[model samples]
Target: MEKHLNIPISADEIRDLKVGESVLLSGIMITGRDAVHKWIHDTFIDKTKPATQEDLDTLSQLKPILDGGLIYHCGPVVSGLETKQYRFVAAGPTTSIREEPYQGDVIHFLNLRGVIGKGGMGPKTLKACHDAPAVYFHAIGGAAALIAESVTEVIGVHKLEFGIPEAIWVIKVKDLPVIVTMDSHNASLHTSVRDQSKSILNRLIEG
Candidate 1:
């Protein structure tokens, strides 16, 4: 049976998932990448410099959007600039490793349940998935248009000053295909794959 995940997913839902399960996601997902991740971390978590009340307000506004939602690591190609009726030309997963340092903290802070991206994350994220009751979904890389076809609408956006790609994009989608690479139980298909590859390489070298 094909698994389908909906937005505002619960901890129980995340816990039910297992690594390597194919899932089709329905409902809303927010697009964000390196900059968005860093901004959230720096503004809220790090506090190297005290954030202004304005910054705090901005974060507050975004919090509800993120709670129990999915974050997509993607920078989409968009059309309809002049008409202001935007359409996704190409939307594919970005390399998720770049957000590794921030993802766990973001998920915990925002109560995020799912993340969609290309390359899998590491120990930190696996631990966070277990801790936060979340999962990481691996969308197929390089199938931009195919993936975009599933997106039903561009609901809204934020941080447009960061430019289109870097800005946070809210999109509605139906049955967007992904694989559960990391699950709420702290299992990681990515780690397994990497370990197996290393073992194979070592054996070949010894021969």
Candidate 2:
């Protein structure tokens, strides 16, 4: 049977999803890369000073904005020239494995229910998926031009001082398309691929 999920999904939710299936996502996804994660961990979610409503809202909108939303893990290109917009605009998915170390925490920190990126996340994040039942989805890589069009709005930004790659951009999107590679119920193509490869290796060694 098909299962429906709520915002800030747990690992349990992801486990049930199948490869190449569709899901309706809702809620916030905080954008970050290596330096950004370090900045956020050092400055926000892990801080002693509590984040104010504005502090949180500056870069994040609540459920109405994200209710049935999906987050794309992308670092975009900056026009870098003097123009109306002097920051990054066109974005492409980053190698998600780079985020394995912090993906789960970021998900939990933002109360995010869905994650979209390339190459997939690792164990901690996979475990987080299991715990939250949130599915990690994937989209065709190198398709940013088509992808950015999906962004309905640039609601706000956080830590703009971090500049470019390290800043958090909160984007609103609709009718985005992606494949379900990782589901909250504890299934993963990464694991299935590894398991099959290992079996082949075992057979080779036995022969």
Candidate 3:
């Protein structure tokens, strides 16, 4: 099934999604990468150390936007940095598996309804989706420029000290295309593919 979803997607909406379904997402989304994920996990989820005032302030700002919303695993190529007028030049999805260690905790902490990225995540994140009633939306790899066209506005950014690619960029999108690779029911296309490949390899070895 193909569906169009707005930001702050409800738990019900996320639960309705299934693996292999197509989704066109509109409204707000935040870009998060390695640094952002680590920060979120350490500061909010694990509490490995105390959160500084700046960390608390950043969390306060993100909580409202992330609650029941989507997080895109992107490291966008940006322009106009000198003028402080940022624009996404190539907003491509990054390798999501790199975030496996932190994604599950971050999702639960933020009340995220969905995640957008290329290359699906792992079992931990799949379990988190089941618990949180969220879904993982797979964006097309190597279509950075085309995807950027869907971004309607750059709302703002936070934690720029993490560097441009790792900063949390709040953006508004219109009809950003993706596929449901992982869903709230604990279904995962990535797991299916991996298992199928393993089975095929086993058969070949046996024969």
Query: Which is the leading candidate under lDDT?
Result: 3
Q: Which ranking of candidates, highest TM-score first? A: 3, 1, 2
Query: Please, what are the lDDT tens digits per residue for candidate 2 over residues 1-207?
Result: 333444455444555567768654433454557666654455476775566676666535443433334456777664533542434356667778877777777666655566788888778887777675566787668887766665555655666677665566776554555678887767788888889999999999998
How far in Å is the alpha carbon of 201 misplaced in model 2? 6.0
- lDDT, ranked from best to worst: 3, 1, 2
Local error of candidate 3 at residue 67 (angstroms): 0.7
**Model 2 local distance difference test score:** 0.64
Q: Candidate 1: deviation at residue 125, Å?
A: 0.5
* Stretches > 4 Å off in candidate 3: none
Question: Which TM-score value belongs to model 2?
Answer: 0.71
TM-score (C-alpha, index-matched) for candidate 1: 0.95
Candidate 3 lDDT (Cα, 0 to 1): 0.91
Better of 1 and 2 by lDDT: 1
Which candidate would rank higher by TM-score, 1 or 3?
3
lDDT of each: 0.89, 0.64, 0.91
Off by over 4 Å in 1: 49-54
**How do all models score by TM-score?**
0.95, 0.71, 0.96
**Could you tell me how far off, in angstroms, the CA of residue 73 lies in candidate 3 after the best superposition?**
0.3
